[model samples]
Target chain A: MINLPWPSGLLAQAAPAEVDYIANSWLGIASYLIAAALFILSLKWLSHPRTARRGVRAGEIGMTIAVIGTLLIYRAVSYKWIFIGMVVGSLIGAPMAVWMPMTAVPQRTALSHAFGALAAALVGTAHYYTLYGDAAIDRFTMAILAVEVLLGSLTFTGSLVAFGKLQELVPSSIKGLPNQNAINFSILGAALVVGIWLTASPMQHWLFPILIILGLAFGLCLVIPIGGADMPTVISLLNSYAGLSASLMGFVLDNYLLIIAGALDGSSGLILSIVMCKAMNRSFTNVLFGRMEPSAGGTSDDIYAGKVKSATPEDVAMLLEGAQRVIFVPGYGLAVAQAQHTVRELATELERNGCTIEYAIHPVAGRMPGHMNVLLAEADVPYDQLKEMDEINPTFAQCDVAIVIGANDVVNPLARTDPNSPIAGMPILNVDQARNVVVIKRSLSPGFAGIPNPLFAADNCLMLFGDGKKALIELVAAMKEG
Target chain B: MHNLEPKLFTFLLATFLGLEVIRRVSPLLHTPLMSLTNAISAISVVAAIQVMSEGHTTFNHVLCTLGVIAAMTNIIGGFWITDRMLKMFRREKPRRD
Candidate 1:
């Protein structure tokens, strides 16, 4: 029989006897190189919203190739458990992706960090015992494993705590234990010492579990003292930890793909942490240690004291009806009350009346970085209509009306005027600069930072008291009627 | 197996590359960026596979099982969520022409 590059015969014939390739093999190396290129391309494509979907596509393709390539490298391992892992994971993961509401994205992000970290830590633990059985572990590999497990375990628990806080399953307030910072630092210090000791003497089996326990302990210690308002920075910092652990896993396995991907994740998290810190105008230390300094700025009653003017939905409708330029400042309240879509309806109604509408998104506004953008974007608001703090701050002056929806600290003029206020140095939306300011909130209750917003009491400001979504729906109906 | 020179070099170079490549991602896409990167780091699935290849022991089986499942979850969820999020961001013209 003449050789025809025999199609079906080749696939079925060679499938059982084909040469297995490791990452160092020519084909495996090529696959890794291609995967790495795709990853870089994935991140690069995210430079604009227009190209972001393409980024996701590139990432999915890259991941598939990496997984297939890794699977082929070894056949001695039992594939049964690995197969079940993927299947069970998909069963859980798919629904989470399909059914989760967009507003739940923060908790979703926190959960991702936890799972990633937990996976890395588990792998490090397995590597330790596998080598220890054969008594062939080396100092360098052991050292890298120690770092990997420490980072992974700590981040795993820390991220879980963050998820709990975001989900409100755990109390979000700081427990304010005495010498809290000192205790946290010492726990971390002890973990580092144990990790270093285990590295030098790999035979000390007792030290290994202790190292892991200390790491797990420090994770809770690190996140427990931070309040809900500080979650953005805390989450970002945990992201960096998760990625760093993965990078150390790379070093242990000598897998260049793991190193590249983990490093990318680490740097991405690092940059986000910087952005979040700058947005809040607080350092990592201040946010983590204690940022709840009493604001000598006094109480909400002192600021409001009958100076506030209350308005109804019809009154807000009339104000919107007369406004030519309107801006919306949305905060965590908008997310809590699920008012995003309704607010968009209100904005659309006003836009039809020839009012130029924009939404000023404070970077740390909702709960995490880009929180408001995700909520507003999910409502089908055009990307161009969503403006960042820096871009929209100056434009608030030209705005005929600034509508504050479930937003407080971001629009509080006290940040700029009162030096003694806790939020004084943080940059705020210049909502007070507008000709008329309307706030939609449930009550005069203080925001997360527990400070009164002076803008609510300003001469040009009026409070529309009600639930955010209900207020928006009523105003939308009123706008349609008029 | 003892030489660590090449691995260290690869890690350093890759990290610097990461710092450079990720600097340009739009802040607007940060939420998606996090999801995608978290998924990417789940490449630690490769590490789990390595661990599973070791001689079968109860401890090894237990560790690798947990490792694979956790990593797989991140791998699946991260990519799924990132794509879902990106799909939400588009320029919708609410303009009445």
Candidate 2:
């Protein structure tokens, strides 16, 4: 029996002898290219609700290819660990994707970002441990590794906190305690100083873990002061952090592919954050330190406690009868009620009754950018029939009936009349302009922005209080009966 | 060219393709996403500085400088643009109302 060297034995058993590097590499490259194409296609498809499912599928396929490519190149001593990790990840991730309510999407996204950050941090730490004593590892490599570990760990912890806030595990809106920002800045400053010192003095390896701890503290300080309303931006920012960490790890590993992918992810995340900020008409600085006064007012119970003029589904259906045109304004309420499909069904019925139906989307209607559009599209609402704020605001006056589904601040008349209102200047859908307005809500509650809506008090506006989906379904039934 | 380098190149190309898909499928526009992505591109700045400071060739130094500048544009300019756009949303009351 021929005795093989231990290194050879490891390599031989790790990969099949029949495997062709040329073919495998080509295949890997091809798979990666295909994945990239799919990702792009998915993004394009996602822009419209009609094609979003296809886009999601495309993205999934691309990710699969990426995973396959990584697996192909990876030479692991033990296969069990990798398989176990994959299984565990899928088990945890699949159910969460399916079971999580649409209302908790922002929290889900934040958690996903935390997972990404943790993965990057783990990779950096593992890489550092593996190559610690190698003479080939230079000061630059060590510095990059330190930076990656620090940023990744911070992103992981910070994202978890953001997730907690979004999930309401902690209070969603907390004002910074006196000197909170100061303390946060000081902690961050100290962490940066320690990080610089550790990198400068390679001899003091003990300082590395200390730097990581400081980074974790900095991340906590960074996210804790941010309000819940700004969670989308925070999630995007954390995503960027995770990407930067991945890029830094790429540098440490001298992997060009990782560098490119990381850079792309980081840039995209940053852009998304900016877009979200723009949608809310807030600067990044404002989001970070601006303590946006919680939309000043009483809670939902206080606002809805008054005599709300409730309309039954039959009444709403009768009101819709003989209406020349109907416009539907959807808000986060619609999303929370998961009433998109029902709204689409209602719209079809209304259209069949010789009433022109259109959807009015406010710029900042839901929690995140494009929230309303995404929900509407999910229900297979036609893109052309959906009108942006600028377009539908004019049309609202011509509509015979305006149906508001779970929308509040965006349709409130106070934005135009009340100077003291927090959301005064922000553009809103002019649902109040319609001849008759019917608001479908669970209660006469304030929206996420926490301001009283005068639209509810308007003489023409009739409040239809109930679950948006159930109300819409009943309305559809009533319309059929009429 | 080495076989490994070509494979690496292909991998990069594939990643770009994936990004394009994400850009398309996303409800947001690619231009904005790309611009925002520039912020993450700042990692290139650190990478460039570290690589150049390591006393590499003049070509490497030039490359690093370019990378740093591009990354800075993405970070600073991107943030500035976002700030300006958001400022427009500041609530101003209608005088007559």
Q: Please name the candidate that would achieve the greatest DockQ relative to the true structure.
A: 1
Docking class of 2: incorrect
Worst 10 residues of 1 chain A by lDDT: A1-10
Q: Can you tell me which runs of candidate 1 are displaced by over 4 Å?
A: A1-24, B1-3, B94-96
lDDT of 2: 0.62
Scoring the B chain of model 2 against the true B chain gives a TM-score of: 0.52
Cα TM-score of candidate 1: 0.94
Clashing pairs in 1: none
A1-482: candidate 2 lDDT, tens digit per residue: 11111232345554655346434544655665575465455445545444544544564556556556644543222234344444555555555545555456556556656666666665555444434443244566667777888898798789889988877787866666778778878887887787777667765667777877888888887888887557667777787787777666655655444566575676556666776676566788777766655555544455445545678889888999889899998887787788888998988788777788888876556655555654565566656676767777887889999999888867877667766667666667888889999999887656766677777877788898889888888989999999
Q: DockQ of every model listed?
A: 0.57, 0.06
Q: On residues A1-482, what C-alpha lDDT tens digit does candidate 1 reach at each position?
A: 01112233345445434433322344555667788889888888987899888988998899888877667664567799889888887887788788889888889889989999999999998888878888978888888899999999899899998899899998877565888888888999999899889889987878888988998988988887777777888888888889889888877776778888888889889888988988887898888777477687678788889899999889988888889999999989999999999988988798788888898888888778788888888998888988878898888889999989888877777778888888888898888999999999999988877888888999999999999999889889999998
